[model samples]
Target: MQAVLNAISDPTRRAALALLQGGEECCVCELMTRLNASQSRMSRHMKMLQDAGLVIGRRDAKWVRYRRNRDLAPEFAAVIDAVLAAERPLEEDMA
Candidate 1:
């Protein structure tokens, strides 16, 4: 879909989703630290992914944790897999 492609066209956003492909939740802080990004910037990127329906977020205390959306068309899942496969190894999660 155009939305998915638009959301993922940015490398940073793609990397964020790739990190989440493992089916585990990660805090916004964790993603910020791992990606070497600031809070506002990471938040904006997360919003884009959320808009695309690729991920979901939950608020816990002072943090927001995000995880991949479980419901997806098979085609979208394949696209995610393809991106993960094409991208290089991810940086360690430093948060």
Candidate 2:
């Protein structure tokens, strides 16, 4: 889907997806810390992922935790899997 393409187009968002694909909900603050991003920056990135249906966030007390939407269409799911498998090298370089 076009939304899936748009969602994974950003390196940061793809990294976020990599984290979320691990099957645990991650806090927005934690994502910002890992990404070295400001709160607003993380929020904006997350909003894009959310709109694309690649992720979903829920209020958890003061923080919103996000995780990948396993309900994604099969085509999109395949893309997420590909990103996870293919982008590890890039993540290591970023580190």
TM-score of each: 0.88, 0.89
Task: List candidate 1 segments past 4 Å from native.
Answer: 89-95
lDDT of 1 by residue, 1-95 (tens): 99999998998898899889999898878999999999999999999999899999989998889999999788998998887776654433433
User: How many pairs of residues in model 2 come into backbone collision?
Assistant: 0
Clash pairs of candidate 2? Answer: none
**Candidate 1, lDDT over the whole model:** 0.88
In candidate 2 the C-alpha lDDT for residue 35 amounts to 83
Scored against the true structure, residue 95 in model 1 reaches a CA lDDT of 33
lDDT for model 2 comes to 0.88
CA RMSD of all predictions: 3.9, 1.6
Q: Give me the displacement of residue 55 in model 2, in angstroms.
A: 0.6
| TM-score of structure candidate 1 | 0.88
Query: What lDDT tens digits, residue by residue, belong to model 2 across residues 2-92?
Result: 8788878998898888888879789989999998888998899999999999899999999999998988888889978987788887768
